[model samples]
Target: MKKRLRDLGEDALIARLLRGFPGGENLRVGPGDDCAVVDPGRGLLRLLKTDAIVEGVHFLPDTPAAKVGWKAVARVLSDFAAMGGVPEHLLVTVAVDPAKPVAWMDGLYRGIRKCLATHGGVLAGGETSRLPSGAMISVAGEGRVERKHLILRSGGKPGDLVVVTGRLGGSIRGKHLTFTPRLNEAAWLVRNLRPSAMMDLSDGLAKDLPRLAEASGCGFEFGEVPATRGCTRAQALGDGEDYELLFTVSPRRWIAAAGQWPKDFPQLSIIGRLCPPGQGASLAGGWDHFSP
Candidate 1:
Protein backbone atom coordinates (compact mmCIF):
# COMPACT_ATOMS: atom_id res chain seq x y z
CA MET A 1 0.00 0.00 0.00
CA LYS A 2 1.22 3.46 -0.84
CA LYS A 3 1.77 5.66 2.18
CA ARG A 4 0.29 9.09 2.38
CA LEU A 5 2.59 12.05 3.02
CA ARG A 6 0.78 12.58 6.32
CA ASP A 7 2.37 9.41 7.61
CA LEU A 8 5.90 10.83 7.55
CA GLY A 9 5.32 14.35 8.94
CA GLU A 10 7.02 17.44 7.55
CA ASP A 11 10.46 16.95 9.03
CA ALA A 12 10.63 13.30 8.09
CA LEU A 13 9.30 13.98 4.63
CA ILE A 14 11.93 16.63 4.12
CA ALA A 15 14.70 14.36 5.27
CA ARG A 16 13.52 11.49 3.09
CA LEU A 17 13.32 13.70 0.02
CA LEU A 18 16.74 15.26 0.63
CA ARG A 19 18.57 12.03 1.37
CA GLY A 20 19.70 11.25 -2.20
CA PHE A 21 20.86 14.66 -3.34
CA PRO A 22 24.64 15.14 -3.53
CA GLY A 23 26.01 18.23 -1.81
CA GLY A 24 28.63 20.01 -3.89
CA GLU A 25 32.15 20.63 -2.63
CA ASN A 26 31.67 24.33 -1.78
CA LEU A 27 28.27 23.87 -0.21
CA ARG A 28 28.86 24.65 3.43
CA VAL A 29 25.22 24.18 4.42
CA GLY A 30 22.41 22.36 2.67
CA PRO A 31 18.60 22.23 2.90
CA GLY A 32 18.29 21.97 6.67
CA ASP A 33 18.81 25.45 8.09
CA ASP A 34 17.17 28.78 7.33
CA CYS A 35 19.52 29.28 4.37
CA ALA A 36 21.88 27.23 2.22
CA VAL A 37 25.50 28.32 2.58
CA VAL A 38 28.26 28.36 -0.02
CA ASP A 39 31.94 29.10 0.44
CA PRO A 40 33.45 31.22 -2.31
CA GLY A 41 36.90 31.58 -0.71
CA ARG A 42 36.20 35.29 -0.08
CA GLY A 43 36.45 35.02 3.70
CA LEU A 44 32.64 34.95 3.71
CA LEU A 45 29.93 32.37 3.20
CA ARG A 46 27.11 33.21 0.83
CA LEU A 47 23.57 32.73 2.13
CA LEU A 48 20.90 31.62 -0.35
CA LYS A 49 17.18 30.84 -0.06
CA THR A 50 14.08 30.91 -2.17
CA ASP A 51 10.69 31.44 -0.52
CA ALA A 52 7.21 31.78 -1.99
CA ILE A 53 3.79 32.71 -0.65
CA VAL A 54 0.50 31.64 -2.17
CA GLU A 55 -2.36 34.12 -2.09
CA GLY A 56 -5.06 32.18 -0.25
CA VAL A 57 -2.69 29.91 1.60
CA HIS A 58 -0.38 32.48 3.15
CA PHE A 59 -2.76 35.45 3.21
CA LEU A 60 -6.40 36.24 2.63
CA PRO A 61 -7.38 37.58 -0.77
CA ASP A 62 -8.79 40.65 0.93
CA THR A 63 -5.41 41.42 2.46
CA PRO A 64 -3.54 44.34 0.96
CA ALA A 65 -1.21 43.45 -1.88
CA ALA A 66 1.47 45.68 -0.40
CA LYS A 67 1.51 43.70 2.81
CA VAL A 68 1.56 40.50 0.79
CA GLY A 69 4.61 41.69 -1.07
CA TRP A 70 6.27 42.84 2.12
CA LYS A 71 5.72 39.44 3.67
CA ALA A 72 7.31 37.74 0.67
CA VAL A 73 10.52 39.76 0.99
CA ALA A 74 10.52 39.79 4.78
CA ARG A 75 10.18 36.03 4.98
CA VAL A 76 13.39 35.45 3.04
CA LEU A 77 15.17 38.23 4.91
CA SER A 78 14.17 36.62 8.16
CA ASP A 79 16.01 33.47 7.09
CA PHE A 80 19.14 35.52 6.48
CA ALA A 81 18.70 37.04 9.92
CA ALA A 82 18.49 33.54 11.40
CA MET A 83 21.92 32.66 10.06
CA GLY A 84 23.62 35.88 11.21
CA GLY A 85 23.94 37.13 7.66
CA VAL A 86 23.17 40.35 5.77
CA PRO A 87 21.00 40.42 2.65
CA GLU A 88 22.65 41.92 -0.39
CA HIS A 89 20.41 41.18 -3.40
CA LEU A 90 16.86 39.98 -4.00
CA LEU A 91 15.21 38.46 -7.06
CA VAL A 92 11.44 38.49 -7.17
CA THR A 93 9.46 36.10 -9.35
CA VAL A 94 5.72 36.58 -9.25
CA ALA A 95 2.85 34.75 -10.90
CA VAL A 96 -0.42 36.59 -11.35
CA ASP A 97 -3.46 36.44 -13.58
CA PRO A 98 -2.89 38.50 -16.68
CA ALA A 99 -6.10 40.39 -15.91
CA LYS A 100 -5.15 41.22 -12.32
CA PRO A 101 -5.72 44.89 -11.52
CA VAL A 102 -2.77 47.20 -12.19
CA ALA A 103 -3.00 48.87 -8.80
CA TRP A 104 -2.74 45.54 -7.00
CA MET A 105 0.51 44.64 -8.74
CA ASP A 106 1.89 48.13 -8.09
CA GLY A 107 1.13 47.97 -4.38
CA LEU A 108 2.80 44.59 -4.06
CA TYR A 109 6.01 45.74 -5.70
CA ARG A 110 5.97 48.91 -3.61
CA GLY A 111 5.96 46.89 -0.43
CA ILE A 112 8.67 44.58 -1.73
CA ARG A 113 10.81 47.59 -2.65
CA LYS A 114 10.52 49.12 0.80
CA CYS A 115 11.78 45.93 2.45
CA LEU A 116 14.73 45.56 0.10
CA ALA A 117 15.72 49.20 0.50
CA THR A 118 15.34 49.12 4.27
CA HIS A 119 17.40 45.97 4.68
CA GLY A 120 20.40 47.14 2.65
CA GLY A 121 19.56 44.98 -0.35
CA VAL A 122 18.63 45.69 -3.95
CA LEU A 123 16.00 44.24 -6.26
CA ALA A 124 18.39 43.30 -9.03
CA GLY A 125 15.73 41.81 -11.36
CA GLY A 126 13.36 38.86 -11.88
CA GLU A 127 10.83 37.25 -14.20
CA THR A 128 7.05 37.52 -14.15
CA SER A 129 4.48 35.00 -15.35
CA ARG A 130 0.71 34.52 -15.57
CA LEU A 131 -0.93 31.91 -13.44
CA PRO A 132 -4.41 30.39 -13.57
CA SER A 133 -5.76 30.99 -10.09
CA GLY A 134 -4.41 32.86 -7.05
CA ALA A 135 -1.23 34.89 -7.34
CA MET A 136 2.10 33.54 -6.14
CA ILE A 137 5.16 35.55 -5.19
CA SER A 138 8.61 34.01 -4.84
CA VAL A 139 11.74 35.72 -3.62
CA ALA A 140 15.29 34.55 -4.07
CA GLY A 141 17.42 36.23 -1.44
CA GLU A 142 21.23 36.36 -1.33
CA GLY A 143 23.24 37.34 1.69
CA ARG A 144 26.73 37.06 3.14
CA VAL A 145 28.18 36.13 6.52
CA GLU A 146 31.71 36.30 7.79
CA ARG A 147 32.93 32.70 7.64
CA LYS A 148 33.53 32.68 11.40
CA HIS A 149 30.28 34.47 12.24
CA LEU A 150 27.85 32.12 10.53
CA ILE A 151 25.56 30.39 13.04
CA LEU A 152 23.73 27.10 12.56
CA ARG A 153 20.91 25.30 14.31
CA SER A 154 23.13 22.26 15.00
CA GLY A 155 25.86 23.73 17.23
CA GLY A 156 23.97 23.85 20.54
CA LYS A 157 25.16 21.73 23.46
CA PRO A 158 24.05 20.77 26.97
CA GLY A 159 24.01 23.51 29.64
CA ASP A 160 23.40 26.29 27.12
CA LEU A 161 20.89 29.08 27.73
CA VAL A 162 17.94 29.08 25.33
CA VAL A 163 16.99 32.68 24.66
CA VAL A 164 14.39 34.41 22.54
CA THR A 165 14.17 37.85 20.98
CA GLY A 166 10.80 39.55 21.56
CA ARG A 167 7.61 37.97 22.89
CA LEU A 168 5.90 34.94 21.39
CA GLY A 169 2.44 33.96 20.19
CA GLY A 170 -0.38 35.80 18.33
CA SER A 171 1.38 36.25 15.05
CA ILE A 172 -1.72 35.22 13.13
CA ARG A 173 -3.42 38.30 14.58
CA GLY A 174 -1.44 40.65 12.28
CA LYS A 175 1.90 40.14 13.98
CA HIS A 176 3.07 37.75 11.27
CA LEU A 177 2.50 40.39 8.63
CA THR A 178 4.50 43.04 10.46
CA PHE A 179 7.03 41.62 12.95
CA THR A 180 10.53 42.80 12.03
CA PRO A 181 13.40 40.30 11.71
CA ARG A 182 16.05 40.54 14.45
CA LEU A 183 19.00 41.04 12.08
CA ASN A 184 20.80 43.63 14.16
CA GLU A 185 20.48 41.56 17.33
CA ALA A 186 21.57 38.33 15.61
CA ALA A 187 24.63 40.11 14.21
CA TRP A 188 25.51 41.54 17.61
CA LEU A 189 25.04 38.23 19.39
CA VAL A 190 27.11 36.25 16.90
CA ARG A 191 29.86 38.87 16.88
CA ASN A 192 30.10 39.46 20.62
CA LEU A 193 29.20 36.12 22.24
CA ARG A 194 29.04 33.10 19.99
CA PRO A 195 25.73 31.33 20.43
CA SER A 196 25.76 27.58 20.74
CA ALA A 197 23.02 27.61 18.06
CA MET A 198 20.31 29.83 16.59
CA MET A 199 17.34 30.07 14.24
CA ASP A 200 14.39 32.33 13.53
CA LEU A 201 11.16 31.20 15.16
CA SER A 202 8.93 30.97 12.09
CA ASP A 203 7.23 27.90 13.46
CA GLY A 204 5.89 27.95 17.01
CA LEU A 205 8.27 27.20 19.84
CA ALA A 206 6.67 23.82 20.45
CA LYS A 207 7.58 22.70 16.95
CA ASP A 208 10.71 24.74 16.30
CA LEU A 209 12.27 24.03 19.68
CA PRO A 210 12.44 20.32 19.03
CA ARG A 211 13.99 21.11 15.67
CA LEU A 212 16.80 23.03 17.33
CA ALA A 213 17.19 20.35 19.96
CA GLU A 214 17.12 17.50 17.46
CA ALA A 215 19.61 19.24 15.23
CA SER A 216 21.93 19.90 18.17
CA GLY A 217 21.67 16.49 19.79
CA CYS A 218 20.17 17.90 22.98
CA GLY A 219 16.92 18.67 24.83
CA PHE A 220 15.52 21.64 26.73
CA GLU A 221 13.71 22.61 29.94
CA PHE A 222 11.87 25.79 30.67
CA GLY A 223 9.66 27.44 33.27
CA GLU A 224 7.61 30.52 32.33
CA VAL A 225 6.96 31.22 28.66
CA PRO A 226 6.67 34.85 27.59
CA ALA A 227 3.23 35.10 26.07
CA THR A 228 2.17 38.12 24.07
CA ARG A 229 -0.89 40.19 24.90
CA GLY A 230 -4.16 38.44 23.94
CA CYS A 231 -2.26 35.17 23.54
CA THR A 232 -2.61 32.06 25.66
CA ARG A 233 0.32 30.01 26.88
CA ALA A 234 -0.67 27.29 24.46
CA GLN A 235 -0.65 29.67 21.54
CA ALA A 236 2.71 30.92 22.70
CA LEU A 237 3.86 27.36 22.40
CA GLY A 238 1.99 26.28 19.27
CA ASP A 239 0.97 29.24 17.11
CA GLY A 240 3.32 29.36 14.16
CA GLU A 241 5.05 32.25 12.33
CA ASP A 242 6.33 34.30 15.26
CA TYR A 243 9.52 35.09 13.25
CA GLU A 244 11.40 35.96 16.43
CA LEU A 245 14.95 34.80 17.03
CA LEU A 246 15.47 31.68 19.19
CA PHE A 247 19.04 30.97 20.20
CA THR A 248 21.26 29.28 22.75
CA VAL A 249 24.47 30.33 24.51
CA SER A 250 26.60 29.14 27.35
CA PRO A 251 25.16 30.36 30.67
CA ARG A 252 28.35 32.19 31.50
CA ARG A 253 28.46 33.97 28.13
CA TRP A 254 24.75 34.76 28.45
CA ILE A 255 25.39 36.71 31.63
CA ALA A 256 27.83 38.97 29.80
CA ALA A 257 25.67 39.15 26.68
CA ALA A 258 22.65 40.05 28.79
CA GLY A 259 24.49 42.85 30.50
CA GLN A 260 25.41 44.29 27.12
CA TRP A 261 22.04 43.74 25.39
CA PRO A 262 21.42 46.83 23.29
CA LYS A 263 18.93 49.24 24.83
CA ASP A 264 17.47 50.02 21.38
CA PHE A 265 17.13 46.45 20.21
CA PRO A 266 14.18 44.13 20.78
CA GLN A 267 13.80 42.77 24.28
CA LEU A 268 15.66 39.50 24.97
CA SER A 269 14.73 36.86 27.51
CA ILE A 270 16.07 33.55 28.74
CA ILE A 271 13.21 31.15 28.19
CA GLY A 272 14.92 27.83 28.85
CA ARG A 273 18.09 25.78 29.13
CA LEU A 274 19.46 22.87 27.14
CA CYS A 275 20.20 19.44 28.61
CA PRO A 276 20.99 15.87 27.68
CA PRO A 277 18.61 14.15 25.31
CA GLY A 278 15.36 12.89 26.88
CA GLN A 279 15.76 15.31 29.77
CA GLY A 280 13.31 18.13 30.52
CA ALA A 281 11.94 18.88 27.07
CA SER A 282 8.46 19.55 25.73
CA LEU A 283 7.63 18.75 22.09
CA ALA A 284 3.90 18.84 21.63
CA GLY A 285 1.25 20.95 19.82
CA GLY A 286 2.69 22.75 16.82
CA TRP A 287 1.63 23.29 13.21
CA ASP A 288 1.71 20.11 11.15
CA HIS A 289 0.70 20.48 7.52
CA PHE A 290 -0.77 17.00 7.17
CA SER A 291 -2.56 16.83 10.53
CA PRO A 292 -6.06 15.49 10.17
Candidate 2:
Protein backbone atom coordinates (compact mmCIF):
# COMPACT_ATOMS: atom_id res chain seq x y z
CA MET A 1 0.00 0.00 0.00
CA LYS A 2 1.18 3.53 -0.80
CA LYS A 3 1.77 6.06 1.99
CA ARG A 4 -0.87 8.78 2.24
CA LEU A 5 -0.08 12.46 1.69
CA ARG A 6 -0.57 13.05 5.39
CA ASP A 7 2.17 10.57 6.15
CA LEU A 8 4.63 12.34 3.83
CA GLY A 9 3.54 15.77 5.19
CA GLU A 10 2.53 18.85 3.22
CA ASP A 11 5.88 20.66 3.11
CA ALA A 12 7.81 17.50 2.29
CA LEU A 13 5.38 16.61 -0.49
CA ILE A 14 5.55 20.10 -2.01
CA ALA A 15 9.35 20.21 -1.94
CA ARG A 16 9.60 16.75 -3.49
CA LEU A 17 6.91 16.98 -6.21
CA LEU A 18 6.45 20.68 -7.04
CA ARG A 19 9.86 22.23 -6.42
CA GLY A 20 11.24 20.95 -9.69
CA PHE A 21 8.60 22.55 -11.96
CA PRO A 22 9.82 24.98 -14.63
CA GLY A 23 10.19 28.69 -13.87
CA GLY A 24 11.19 32.05 -15.48
CA GLU A 25 9.76 33.83 -18.58
CA ASN A 26 7.03 36.42 -18.02
CA LEU A 27 6.51 35.06 -14.55
CA ARG A 28 6.81 38.27 -12.52
CA VAL A 29 6.05 36.38 -9.36
CA GLY A 30 5.57 32.66 -8.95
CA PRO A 31 4.01 30.31 -6.45
CA GLY A 32 4.36 30.91 -2.66
CA ASP A 33 1.57 33.42 -2.34
CA ASP A 34 -2.20 33.71 -2.73
CA CYS A 35 -1.61 33.93 -6.50
CA ALA A 36 1.23 34.14 -9.03
CA VAL A 37 1.75 37.19 -11.26
CA VAL A 38 2.88 37.21 -14.87
CA ASP A 39 3.50 40.54 -16.53
CA PRO A 40 2.72 40.76 -20.25
CA GLY A 41 4.55 44.10 -20.59
CA ARG A 42 3.62 47.79 -20.19
CA GLY A 43 0.67 48.28 -22.53
CA LEU A 44 -2.16 45.83 -22.04
CA LEU A 45 -1.12 44.28 -18.76
CA ARG A 46 -1.71 40.57 -19.04
CA LEU A 47 -2.12 38.96 -15.65
CA LEU A 48 -1.51 35.25 -15.32
CA LYS A 49 -2.52 33.26 -12.28
CA THR A 50 -2.63 29.56 -11.57
CA ASP A 51 -4.11 27.38 -8.85
CA ALA A 52 -4.22 23.68 -8.02
CA ILE A 53 -6.38 21.10 -6.34
CA VAL A 54 -4.94 17.90 -4.99
CA GLU A 55 -6.93 14.92 -3.77
CA GLY A 56 -6.25 15.72 -0.14
CA VAL A 57 -5.28 19.38 0.18
CA HIS A 58 -8.30 20.87 -1.57
CA PHE A 59 -11.01 18.27 -1.27
CA LEU A 60 -11.94 14.93 0.20
CA PRO A 61 -10.81 11.87 -1.73
CA ASP A 62 -14.45 10.97 -2.32
CA THR A 63 -15.53 14.40 -3.54
CA PRO A 64 -17.23 14.44 -6.95
CA ALA A 65 -14.58 14.49 -9.66
CA ALA A 66 -16.56 16.98 -11.75
CA LYS A 67 -16.95 19.52 -8.94
CA VAL A 68 -13.26 19.11 -8.19
CA GLY A 69 -12.54 20.13 -11.76
CA TRP A 70 -14.84 23.14 -11.55
CA LYS A 71 -13.23 24.31 -8.33
CA ALA A 72 -9.81 24.15 -9.94
CA VAL A 73 -10.85 26.50 -12.73
CA ALA A 74 -12.91 28.75 -10.50
CA ARG A 75 -9.92 29.42 -8.24
CA VAL A 76 -7.89 31.01 -11.03
CA LEU A 77 -10.91 32.83 -12.49
CA SER A 78 -11.60 34.36 -9.12
CA ASP A 79 -8.06 35.79 -9.06
CA PHE A 80 -8.60 37.41 -12.43
CA ALA A 81 -11.91 38.81 -11.27
CA ALA A 82 -10.20 40.33 -8.26
CA MET A 83 -7.61 41.99 -10.49
CA GLY A 84 -10.39 43.51 -12.60
CA GLY A 85 -9.26 41.66 -15.70
CA VAL A 86 -11.15 39.76 -18.38
CA PRO A 87 -10.12 36.13 -18.68
CA GLU A 88 -9.17 35.26 -22.25
CA HIS A 89 -7.71 31.77 -22.04
CA LEU A 90 -6.62 28.92 -19.78
CA LEU A 91 -4.01 26.17 -19.65
CA VAL A 92 -4.88 23.03 -17.77
CA THR A 93 -2.44 20.39 -16.48
CA VAL A 94 -3.40 17.18 -14.82
CA ALA A 95 -1.56 14.39 -13.03
CA VAL A 96 -3.44 11.26 -12.28
CA ASP A 97 -2.68 7.91 -10.72
CA PRO A 98 -2.91 4.87 -13.01
CA ALA A 99 -5.82 3.41 -11.09
CA LYS A 100 -8.24 6.28 -11.87
CA PRO A 101 -10.65 5.58 -14.72
CA VAL A 102 -10.39 7.45 -18.02
CA ALA A 103 -14.00 8.50 -17.50
CA TRP A 104 -12.93 10.57 -14.53
CA MET A 105 -10.57 12.56 -16.73
CA ASP A 106 -13.41 13.07 -19.22
CA GLY A 107 -15.70 14.35 -16.49
CA LEU A 108 -13.03 16.76 -15.29
CA TYR A 109 -12.49 18.11 -18.78
CA ARG A 110 -16.23 18.51 -19.22
CA GLY A 111 -16.40 20.63 -16.08
CA ILE A 112 -13.51 22.82 -17.22
CA ARG A 113 -15.16 23.26 -20.61
CA LYS A 114 -18.43 24.27 -18.99
CA CYS A 115 -16.76 26.98 -16.89
CA LEU A 116 -14.64 28.34 -19.76
CA ALA A 117 -17.73 28.57 -21.97
CA THR A 118 -19.72 30.38 -19.30
CA HIS A 119 -16.93 32.93 -18.80
CA GLY A 120 -16.16 33.50 -22.50
CA GLY A 121 -12.67 32.11 -22.10
CA VAL A 122 -10.88 29.66 -24.40
CA LEU A 123 -8.90 26.57 -23.58
CA ALA A 124 -5.30 27.16 -24.59
CA GLY A 125 -3.03 24.18 -23.91
CA GLY A 126 -1.32 22.30 -21.08
CA GLU A 127 0.73 19.28 -20.15
CA THR A 128 -0.32 15.96 -18.71
CA SER A 129 1.69 13.16 -17.08
CA ARG A 130 1.17 10.11 -14.99
CA LEU A 131 1.44 10.82 -11.28
CA PRO A 132 1.77 7.13 -10.47
CA SER A 133 1.01 8.06 -6.88
CA GLY A 134 -1.80 10.61 -6.43
CA ALA A 135 -4.14 12.84 -8.40
CA MET A 136 -3.43 16.55 -9.03
CA ILE A 137 -4.90 19.24 -11.25
CA SER A 138 -3.44 22.66 -12.08
CA VAL A 139 -4.95 25.53 -14.05
CA ALA A 140 -3.23 28.60 -15.43
CA GLY A 141 -5.49 31.49 -16.42
CA GLU A 142 -4.58 34.40 -18.67
CA GLY A 143 -6.42 37.67 -18.47
CA ARG A 144 -5.89 41.26 -19.63
CA VAL A 145 -6.96 44.81 -18.92
CA GLU A 146 -5.90 48.19 -20.23
CA ARG A 147 -2.75 49.37 -18.46
CA LYS A 148 -4.65 52.25 -16.90
CA HIS A 149 -7.52 50.03 -15.84
CA LEU A 150 -5.33 47.41 -14.21
CA ILE A 151 -5.88 47.75 -10.47
CA LEU A 152 -3.11 46.91 -8.03
CA ARG A 153 -2.85 46.75 -4.26
CA SER A 154 -0.64 49.86 -4.23
CA GLY A 155 -2.94 52.69 -5.27
CA GLY A 156 -4.96 53.62 -2.24
CA LYS A 157 -4.79 57.10 -0.73
CA PRO A 158 -5.69 58.47 2.63
CA GLY A 159 -9.37 59.33 3.03
CA ASP A 160 -10.29 56.85 0.30
CA LEU A 161 -13.18 54.62 1.23
CA VAL A 162 -12.47 50.92 1.44
CA VAL A 163 -15.21 48.86 -0.11
CA VAL A 164 -16.01 45.20 -0.57
CA THR A 165 -18.25 43.43 -3.03
CA GLY A 166 -20.46 40.68 -1.64
CA ARG A 167 -20.32 39.22 1.86
CA LEU A 168 -17.54 37.08 3.34
CA GLY A 169 -16.75 33.89 5.29
CA GLY A 170 -18.06 30.33 5.78
CA SER A 171 -17.15 29.45 2.23
CA ILE A 172 -16.52 25.81 3.14
CA ARG A 173 -20.21 25.35 3.83
CA GLY A 174 -20.99 25.39 0.07
CA LYS A 175 -19.80 28.68 -1.46
CA HIS A 176 -16.27 27.37 -1.95
CA LEU A 177 -17.27 24.96 -4.71
CA THR A 178 -20.31 26.76 -6.16
CA PHE A 179 -19.50 30.49 -6.08
CA THR A 180 -19.56 32.33 -9.39
CA PRO A 181 -16.56 34.38 -10.53
CA ARG A 182 -17.10 38.14 -10.08
CA LEU A 183 -15.75 38.99 -13.52
CA ASN A 184 -18.76 41.04 -14.57
CA GLU A 185 -18.85 43.01 -11.37
CA ALA A 186 -15.14 43.82 -11.54
CA ALA A 187 -15.29 44.97 -15.16
CA TRP A 188 -18.23 47.17 -14.38
CA LEU A 189 -16.41 48.68 -11.44
CA VAL A 190 -13.28 49.41 -13.41
CA ARG A 191 -15.30 51.05 -16.20
CA ASN A 192 -17.38 53.09 -13.79
CA LEU A 193 -15.91 53.85 -10.37
CA ARG A 194 -12.25 53.33 -11.30
CA PRO A 195 -11.12 52.03 -7.97
CA SER A 196 -7.85 53.39 -6.63
CA ALA A 197 -6.77 49.90 -5.60
CA MET A 198 -8.34 46.48 -5.68
CA MET A 199 -7.78 42.79 -4.93
CA ASP A 200 -9.71 39.67 -4.08
CA LEU A 201 -10.16 38.34 -0.59
CA SER A 202 -8.54 34.92 -0.90
CA ASP A 203 -6.53 34.88 2.31
CA GLY A 204 -9.16 36.74 4.27
CA LEU A 205 -9.21 40.51 4.89
CA ALA A 206 -7.00 40.03 7.93
CA LYS A 207 -3.97 38.86 5.96
CA ASP A 208 -4.76 40.34 2.52
CA LEU A 209 -5.83 43.83 3.54
CA PRO A 210 -2.57 44.48 5.33
CA ARG A 211 -0.65 43.42 2.27
CA LEU A 212 -2.67 45.87 0.23
CA ALA A 213 -2.05 48.60 2.73
CA GLU A 214 1.67 47.91 2.64
CA ALA A 215 1.67 47.96 -1.12
CA SER A 216 -0.22 51.25 -1.26
CA GLY A 217 1.99 52.75 1.47
CA CYS A 218 -0.99 53.50 3.66
CA GLY A 219 -3.01 52.14 6.55
CA PHE A 220 -6.68 51.21 7.03
CA GLU A 221 -9.51 51.59 9.48
CA PHE A 222 -12.64 49.51 9.36
CA GLY A 223 -15.68 51.00 11.08
CA GLU A 224 -18.21 48.49 9.86
CA VAL A 225 -17.48 45.27 8.05
CA PRO A 226 -20.35 43.70 6.16
CA ALA A 227 -21.03 40.12 7.16
CA THR A 228 -22.41 37.10 5.35
CA ARG A 229 -25.72 35.51 6.36
CA GLY A 230 -24.39 33.57 9.32
CA CYS A 231 -20.84 34.86 9.54
CA THR A 232 -19.55 36.40 12.71
CA ARG A 233 -17.40 39.52 12.79
CA ALA A 234 -14.31 37.38 13.27
CA GLN A 235 -15.23 34.92 10.56
CA ALA A 236 -16.09 37.75 8.19
CA LEU A 237 -12.63 39.19 8.72
CA GLY A 238 -10.50 36.05 8.86
CA ASP A 239 -12.03 33.21 6.84
CA GLY A 240 -10.01 32.71 3.66
CA GLU A 241 -11.25 32.02 0.12
CA ASP A 242 -14.11 34.53 0.18
CA TYR A 243 -13.28 35.48 -3.44
CA GLU A 244 -14.99 38.88 -3.11
CA LEU A 245 -13.40 42.07 -4.39
CA LEU A 246 -12.00 44.48 -1.80
CA PHE A 247 -11.24 47.93 -3.14
CA THR A 248 -10.54 51.54 -2.29
CA VAL A 249 -11.99 54.64 -3.91
CA SER A 250 -11.93 58.39 -3.36
CA PRO A 251 -14.45 59.34 -0.70
CA ARG A 252 -16.32 61.83 -2.84
CA ARG A 253 -16.98 59.41 -5.65
CA TRP A 254 -17.51 56.43 -3.42
CA ILE A 255 -20.35 58.16 -1.59
CA ALA A 256 -21.80 59.60 -4.79
CA ALA A 257 -21.73 56.29 -6.62
CA ALA A 258 -22.85 54.04 -3.79
CA GLY A 259 -26.53 54.43 -4.61
CA GLN A 260 -25.92 54.11 -8.33
CA TRP A 261 -24.42 50.61 -8.19
CA PRO A 262 -26.28 47.82 -9.95
CA LYS A 263 -29.26 46.46 -8.06
CA ASP A 264 -28.20 42.90 -8.75
CA PHE A 265 -25.04 43.43 -6.67
CA PRO A 266 -26.49 45.46 -3.84
CA GLN A 267 -24.16 43.83 -1.40
CA LEU A 268 -21.38 46.26 -2.31
CA SER A 269 -20.73 48.31 0.82
CA ILE A 270 -18.17 50.69 2.29
CA ILE A 271 -16.49 48.94 5.15
CA GLY A 272 -13.51 51.17 5.96
CA ARG A 273 -11.13 53.92 4.82
CA LEU A 274 -7.50 54.26 3.94
CA CYS A 275 -5.68 55.87 6.82
CA PRO A 276 -2.51 57.95 7.04
CA PRO A 277 0.95 56.42 6.71
CA GLY A 278 1.52 55.37 10.30
CA GLN A 279 -1.79 53.74 11.14
CA GLY A 280 -1.08 50.32 9.57
CA ALA A 281 -3.67 47.51 9.11
CA SER A 282 -6.03 47.02 12.02
CA LEU A 283 -7.34 43.54 11.26
CA ALA A 284 -4.27 41.32 11.25
CA GLY A 285 -5.02 37.61 11.25
CA GLY A 286 -5.86 34.96 8.64
CA TRP A 287 -5.07 31.50 7.22
CA ASP A 288 -1.46 30.57 6.54
CA HIS A 289 -0.84 27.05 5.24
CA PHE A 290 2.49 26.61 7.01
CA SER A 291 1.93 28.70 10.10
CA PRO A 292 1.79 26.93 13.43
Off by over 4 Å in 1: none
Best by lDDT: 1
What TM-score would every model get versus the actual structure?
A: 0.96, 0.84
C-alpha displacement of 43 in model 1, angstroms?
Answer: 1.7
lDDT of 1 by residue, 1-292 (tens): 8999987788888888888899999998999999999998678899999988888778877788888988999999999989999998899999988888999999999989887777778898898999997799999979999988899999999999898888889888897776677788888888997898999987799999889988999988987778898899999999988898999999888777667867887778889899999888677878877565
Clashing pairs in 1: none
lDDT of each: 0.87, 0.79
Q: Number of backbone collisions per candidate, in order? A: 0, 0
Model 2: residue 99 alpha-carbon error in angstroms = 1.6
lDDT of 2 at 260: 76
Index of the highest-TM-score prediction = 1
Off by over 4 Å in 2: 1-43
